[model samples]
Target: MKKYLIPLLAISLIWGCKKEVKKADESKEIMTTEDEGWTYLFDGKSFDGWHTYLQDTISSQWQIEDGVMFYKPDPDKNQGMNNLITDKTYKNYELSLDWKISVDGNSGVFYGVLEDKKFVVPYMTAPEIQIRDYTNIPDFTDKQQMSGAIFGIVGIEKDVANKAGEWNHFLIRIDHDKNQGSVILNDQEVAKFPVNGEAWEALVENSKFKDWEGFGITQNGHIGLQDHAHGVWFRNIKIKEL
Candidate 1:
C-alpha cells in the first residue's frame, strides 16, 4: 500500500509541474506588447469611442457598415451634417487610416480639431488631409485637393488618390514639440509643413480659418472626418502616440 501511494503522489506532482509549464507557455503567447504604444481607435467593428464633432451622440448620417465608417447622404442636413470626431483628445501622434470614395465623392481627415460648438465648420479648427475622386469630381481644381493635401493650406503636386471606389492609404504625423506636421500617401511623402512657423502663419492668414483662435493650434484635440454630402468609407483607423 505504501509503495502504491508513493508512486501516485509522484505522478500527481509531475502532472502539476507540467500544467504549470503549459500555463507559462500559453501566457507568453497571450501577453504581447506589440501594441503597447499604439491604440486602435477603430477596429472595423464598432463606433464605441467616436461621436459627432460637437455633439455627444453620433449623427444619423454616419454609419458603421461592412467594417467601415461610412457617410450616407441626406440632402436635408446642414453644412456640418456628416462630421464625426474621436471621443478622446490627442496632442502629438501618428495617425493612419484608409479611405475610399464613391464617384464624385469628397471627404477629409482632420486633426487638431477643437470641440467648440461656436465653430460652424470643422475645418476652421482643424487642418485636413483632403480626399476626393479627382477624375470624377470636375470641380476638384487643385491638385492639393486631390488626396493627402493639407486642404487649402498645402497641395500635392501630383495625384496619388486611387480610382473612385478603391481604397487609398493615408499616414499623418504631428509633432507638437517641433511644431511640425507631415503627410504620407501610399508610402510617399506628399507634404511636410511646420505647424506654427511662418509658412503655417501665412496659410492661416490667407485661408478662411484665419479668424478662429484655435485654428491650426496643435496642442491637443480630437481627430475628425468630413461628411461632404456623399458616400465615403474609412477603415483600419489606428494611432500611435509620439
Candidate 2:
C-alpha cells in the first residue's frame, strides 16, 4: 500500500509542476509590454498619422481637445463627405477605439480603404463598422443598418450602442491571411464574416456594395473614420498587427 501511494504521489507532483509552468508561460504571453506591436493612431494630443481621405493633410474641422479626436462641421466649409483616413495602410491587424456620437449623429470606422480620389468615398472601397446614435437615428430600418453592423454585408444582433454623448467601445479584428474578421461593440461580440472567397463574394453580390467600385476588393488599405456630416468624438484609437 505504501509503495503504490508513492507512485501516485509522484505522478501528482509532476502534473502539478507542469500546470504551474504552463500558467506562467501564458501569463507572460498576455502581459502588456512596451512595444507589444501596438501603434497609437490617436496619441491624445495630435493626429500625427491620419489625414483626410484622398487628401494630403488633416482638415481644420477635425480637432483634438481634451485628448479626444473630434469632428465639428465647419458649416461654411463642408467638404464633400470624405472620411479621415490613415496615411499609412495596414494589412492584418486588430484595432480598438472608443467613440461618442451626438444625438441624431452618424459616423463609421472603415478598413480596407483604397485611397484613390476616383472612388469618391471611403465606403466605395471598404467595409464600415457603423458608429451611430441608435436612439435618434431613423435610418436604421434593418439590423444590417444598425450600429456595429458590417455596413450592409451583415447585421449585428446585439444593440449595445450607448446613448449619444456616452462612450462606446469597439474592437475590430481583421486577418487577411485567415480570411476572417469580427466586430465587437461595447464588449459584446456582434458580427463575424469571411473576408474573401465565395462566401464573401456571395454576400457582396447580395448586398448594396455589389457594384460599388473597389468595394472589398483589396485585403490591405487605410483605416477610415467617416464624418457623415455629424458631430462625433473618438479617442484611445490603437492597433496591433496580427
Candidate 3:
C-alpha cells in the first residue's frame, strides 16, 4: 500500500509540472505577438477598409492623395457635414496617426464610436480628440479646442501643433481596465483622463453627452475622423491593442 501511495504522488507531481510548462509556453506565445507591435489601420493608398460613418460608401469629399487620406472641404459646404470611419472595431489600444489641418480648419480623431444612424449622424455616439489650428482657427476660444484636447472634456497645455500646413503626430492610449485614457502630441504627453468612471461621469453629467447611452463605453468600436468642412490629411494611422 505504501509503495503504491508513493507512486501515485510522484505521478501527480509530474502531471502538475507538465501543466505548468504548457502554460508558460502559451504565455510566451502571447507575449511574442504583443511584441510584434501595431497594425496599420490605413493602407495609405486606398479606403478599401473604411467607410463613411454609418454609411456603406466613402463620401465624395474624402479622398486618398499623395499617400494620405485627406478630407477635401468644399468652399460651398457647411460645417459638420462629413465623417469617415474604419471598418473594424477596437477596444483598448494605442492609436497613432499623422495629421495636418488647413488654415482655420477644424477636425478630430474619435474612438469608441458605435455606428448608429438613428440621429442625423454617428458622431453623437463618440467622444472626440479635437484637432484644430489653435493659433489660426478663429472659432475656438479655449484651450480645450486645441490640437490635443479631449475636446470639451479636457484641455492640453502645450501648443504642439506644427504650422497650419505641416504634419503633426498624435498618439492616443486608451486603457479600459484602468478606465483611463491619454493623449500625446509630437512625443509629448498632453492630456489624460479617466473614462466611464468618476472623472468621466462628472464631465458627462452636465455636457451634451449626458443622455447618450454608448458614449465613452470603450469596449469595441470604430475609429473615426471628423470632416468639419476643411482640408485635413491623415496618414500612417495604426493601432496596437492593450
The digit string of per-residue lDDT tens for model 1 on 1-242 reads 99999999999999999999999988886655545677889978788888877677777777787788888887777655648888998888999888899888888998888888778767778898888786655666676677888888788877767898999888899888888899898888888887777778898888766887878875688899997887899998989999
- RMSD of every candidate to native, in Å, equals 5.2, 8.9, 11.7
By lDDT rank, best first, the candidates go 2, 1, 3
lDDT computed for candidate 2: 0.87
Q: Estimate each model's TM-score.
A: 0.81, 0.83, 0.79
lDDT per residue, candidate 3, 214-237, as tens digits? 777656788889988888999988
**lDDT (Cα, 0-100) at 239 in candidate 1:** 96
Where does candidate 2 stray beyond 4 Å? 1-35, 137-141
Better of 1 and 2 by TM-score: 2
Cα misplacement distance, residue 221 of candidate 3 (Å) = 1.5
Alpha-carbon error at 210 in model 2, in Å? Answer: 0.7
lDDT (0 to 1) per candidate: 0.83, 0.87, 0.83
RMSD of 2: 8.9
Ranking by TM-score: 2, 1, 3
lDDT of 2 by residue, 77-145 (tens): 775465799988988999999999989888899998898868888988999888877575455577887
- Give lDDT: candidate 1, residue 75: 79
The regions of model 3 sitting more than 4 angstroms off are: 1-35, 76-79, 137-141
Q: How many backbone clashes does candidate 1 have?
A: 0
In model 1, the runs with Cα more than 4 Å from the true position are: 1-36, 76-79, 137-141
